[model samples]
Target: AKLVAATHNPGKVPEIAALLDGRFEIVTAGQLGLPEPEETESTFVGNALLKARHAADLSGLPALADDSGLSVKALDGAPGIYSARWAGPGKDFAMAMDKVAERIEATGTEDYAAWFTSALAVAWPNGPAVVVEGRVDGSLVFPGRGTRGFGYDPVFIPAGESLTFGEMEPTAKDAMSHRARAFAKLKAALFD
Candidate 1:
C-alpha cells in the first residue's frame, strides 16, 4: 500500500518515513503536490486528524500526519500548537529559539521546564481514523546548540540527557523523541 505522509515539511518526512519502517511505500503530501490544508484545530491531535483526512480524501489512499511542538512551562505552554508559526514564514527556527529565550527571560525566572508533544493520525479514504499522542519532558537551553535536528532541537535537552536534540545522533534522538513514542503506539495499533 502507498501511504501518504501528510506533511509539507521536508524535515518531518524522513522522521515519519523511518518510523514507518518499510511497512508501505511512503509518499509525502508535498511530493504529491498537495496544498497544505489550514490547521484550524486548536490541539495537536485535532490538527493531525485534519491533515490526515485531507490527504487521504485527496489522494484516495491512507494518509498519516503528525502535529508536534514544544511547550515551555514558564511560557505557560506557549508555542504549543503555534510552534510552527513561531518560526515565521521562512521557518527560521533560530529566530524562534531566540524568541523563546526572550520570553522566558521576560518572565524573570530561570525555569526552563518544557516538553515536546507529537500527535499522530492515520486516516483512510473511506474508513475510521486512528490517532495517538506522545510527549517527552525536558528543559530549554539558550544560544542553541548543534545543527543536526531541525526546529527547536537546538534548544531542547531531553530529560536525563545533557545534549540537545540537535546535538544527539539521529538514532539516539529517535529512540526517545515524542514522535517516536507516538509512532510506537501507532505501530502497535495499526501494524503490530
Candidate 2:
C-alpha cells in the first residue's frame, strides 16, 4: 500500500514513517508535490482532518496526518494548537521553549502539570476522516535537557520518568510517546 504522509514537517515525517514500518510504502506530501493546507481549524483533530483530506484529495491516495502540541495547565492550555506558532516561521523551538520557561517564572507557577496531545487522522480520497487522540501526562523542566527528540522534548518530563524525551533513546521515546498511543489506536481501527 502506498500511503501519503500528510505533513511538511521534516521531524514528523521520519517519526510517522518509522511507525508505519513494513506496513506501507510511505510517500510524503512533499514527494508528491502536494502543497500544505492551512491549519485553520481550532482543535488538533480538526487540523489533522484538514491536512489529511487535503493530501488525499491532491494525491488520490490514503493520507495520514497528525496534529500535536504541548498543553500546560498553568498556561491555561495555551500553546496547545499554537505550539508550532510559538516556534514561529523560523521554527526556533529553543527560543519558544525559553519563552515557556520565562512565562512560567513570571506567573510564579509552581505546578508544572502539563501533557502532550496528539490527534491523528486518516483520510481517503472519496470520504470521511477517522481521527484518534492520545495524550501523555507530565511536568515541565527548565533549561531543556538532553538532545534527542524535537520540539519541547528537552523540557518535558513524563509522569514517571526522570529523563525527558530528549534524553531517552529514540526507540524508548517511540514506545511511550503520545503519537505512539494514538497510532496504536489507529492501527487497531484500520488494520485489526
Candidate 3:
C-alpha cells in the first residue's frame, strides 16, 4: 500500500521510514507536493491528526503524521508544541538551544529535567483515524554536545543515560527515541 508521510521535514522522513520498513512504500508529502497544514491545535495529538487527515485527503492514501516537541518540567512544559518555531524560520536550532539554556539559567533553579514527546496519528481516506503517543524522559544539559541528531537532541540525556541523544549513533538513538516508541505502537495497531 502507498503511505503518505505528512511532513516536509527531511529529517523526520528517514527515521519514520526506517521504523515502518517493509510495511508500506512510504512517500513524503513533499514528494506529492502536499503542503504542511497549519498546526493550530494546542496538543500534539490534535495537530498530528489534523496533518494526517489533510495528507490523506490530498493524496487519497493512508497517511501518517507526527507532532513532537521538547517539554521541560521546569519550563511548565513550554516549548512543548513549539519546538520547531522556537528556533524560527531559518531552522536555527542553536538559537533555540541558547534560548532554552538562558531560560533555565534565569529560573534560578538548576532543574534541567525535560522530556521529548512524540504523538503519531494515522488517517485513512474513509476510515477512523488513530493516534498514539510516546515519550523519552531525559534531562537537559548546558553546553550542548554532539552533532548527530537535530533540534534539542544535543542537550537531552535520555533516562538512565549520561550521553545526549545527539551523541549516540542514529541506529542507537532510533532504537529508543520517542518517535520510535510511538511508531512501534502505531505499527502494532495497524499491522499486528
Candidate 4:
C-alpha cells in the first residue's frame, strides 16, 4: 500500500517511515507535489485531520498527519498550538529558544515543567478518519543541548532522563517520543 505523509517537514518523513513494517510505501506531500493546507484548526486533532483530509482528498490515497507541540506548565500551556509560530516565519529556533529561556528566567522558579503532545490523524478520501493523541511529560532546559532532533528537541528533557531528545539517536528518541506513542496506537488500530 502507498500512503502520503501529509507534512512539509522532511525530517519527520523518515521517523514515520521507520515505524512502518514494510506494509506500506510512504511518500511525503513534497514528493507528491501536494500543497500544504492552512492549519486554521484550533486543536491538534482538528489540525491533524485538516492536513490528512486535504492530502487524501487531493491524492486519492490514505493520508497521515500529525500536529505536535511543546506545552509548558509554567507558561500555562502556551506555545501549544503556536509552538511552530514561536520559531517565527524563518523557523529560527535559536531565537525561539532564547525567548523560552527568557521566560523561564523571569518566572524565577526552578520548575521547568513541560510536555510534548502529538495528535495523529489518518484519513481516507472517502471520508473515514481516525485521530489519536499522545503526550510525554518532562521539562525544558535553557541553552538548548544536542543537535539531533529539530524544533524544541534541544530544550526538552523527558521525564526520568537527563539527555534531551536532540541528544538521543532517532531510534532511541522514537522509543519513547509522544509521536511514537501515538503511532503505536494508530498501528494497533489500523495496521495490527
Tens digit of per-residue lDDT, candidate 3, span 67-154: 9999998899989999999999999999999999899888989788899999999999877799999999989988999998788889
TM-score ranking from best candidate downward? 1, 2, 3, 4
Ten residues in a row with the worst lDDT in model 1? 14-23
User: How well is each residue in 76-135 modelled by candidate 1, as lDDT tens digits?
Assistant: 999999999999999999899999999999999979999999999999998889999999
The deviation in Å at residue 75 for candidate 1 is 0.9
CA lDDT for candidate 1: 0.94
| Residue 102 miss distance in model 2 (angstroms) | 1.3
Give the range where candidate 2 is weakest over 10 consecutive residues by summed lDDT.
13-22
In lDDT terms, which candidate is top?
1
All models, RMSD in angstroms: 0.7, 0.9, 1.0, 1.1
| lDDT accuracy of residue 24 in candidate 4 | 84
> Of the candidates numbered 1 and 4, which has the greater TM-score value?
1
Off by over 4 Å in 1: none
Backbone collision count in every prediction? 0, 0, 0, 0
Return the TM-score for each candidate structure: 0.98, 0.97, 0.97, 0.96
Candidate 3, run of 10 with poorest lDDT: 14-23
Segments in model 2 whose C-alpha atoms lie over 4 Å from true places: none
Local accuracy of candidate 2 as per-residue lDDT tens digits, 13-42: 767977776699999999899998889999
lDDT (C-alpha) at residue 16 in model 2 = 90
* Cα error of candidate 1 at position 167, Å: 0.7
